[model samples]
Target: MELYKWSAQATGLGCYAYFCWCCFLGSLAEDINESKTSCCCISNILAVYRMKVRATLKIRGDSFSDACVVCWCPFCAGLQMRNELRNRGLA
Candidate 1:
């Protein structure tokens, strides 16, 4: 995958993101029996963040699709976003 090829070029952003995801998952496991809304809280936040990143980067995409992509594979989404920012000399 492109991610693997670009692993050597990856910035600290990806590692930070993966750490956050791991922490979120750990907390979620502890609250596995909690409400659905609680479980979705982090996903929703990340989705909104993704939308903002897309908008700020002037990337052409719909918010809903961005949310879907973030929710589906946040690790990849974060990596792509970081790469975009780096490419633009903003990261």
Candidate 2:
């Protein structure tokens, strides 16, 4: 994942997420749910969505592992998703 490769859009998203992570989560969740990208703000649903993201990105992990990552550090996960999507021209 291009974690350090922040475009203007990603930079803005990172800033927003850094300050209002909950709100950012909600926004990202909506994007994930409504757009071709997928996920949700709720922890349970988000965990499931994280699995989908893993599949979409071809990342290696199980449901429990993805859940743990999302639970512990959703912002990082979101940022990674954003970068991946942008990289694939899917965002």
Candidate 3:
């Protein structure tokens, strides 16, 4: 993929961009889940986030898995997400 090719060119930008993207995604996921869940005493929301990423990206998502993928191919990943959401009537 183009990501593999360009990743080497933008090492600095990739690190910065990828970090921001991962934080954004994690926070976004948390916010959505919090909105849907009214109960308290939940501290393991990130596990739910891992599952969401795994389901959406169709890949095994460890702690850094989503970050690596977004780092590899951010544009493609975003496009894929938009398309998936639109298809599911959530976009």
Best by TM-score: 2
The positional error of residue 85 in candidate 1, measured at the CA in angstroms, is: 0.8
User: Which number leads on lDDT?
Assistant: 2
Better of 1 and 3 by TM-score: 1
What ranges in model 1 sit over 4 Å off? 1-41
The 10-residue segment of model 1 with minimum total lDDT is 1-10
For candidate 1, lDDT tens digit of each residue in 1-91? 1111222233456555576765543333332222334435666755665576666555677878888887788667656655655566665
How much does each candidate deviate from the true structure in C-alpha RMSD?
Answer: 9.9, 5.9, 9.8
For model 3, residues 1-91, the per-residue Cα lDDT tens digits are 1111111122333343355655434434443453424222122443444346446545443546545555666534433443444445543
> Each candidate: what lDDT?
0.55, 0.62, 0.41
Q: What TM-score number comes out for model 3?
A: 0.34
TM-score of 2: 0.61
Model 1, CA-based lDDT: 0.55
Question: Candidates ranked by TM-score, best first?
Answer: 2, 1, 3
Against the true structure, what is each candidate's TM-score? 0.56, 0.61, 0.34
Between prediction 1 and prediction 2, which has the larger lDDT? Answer: 2
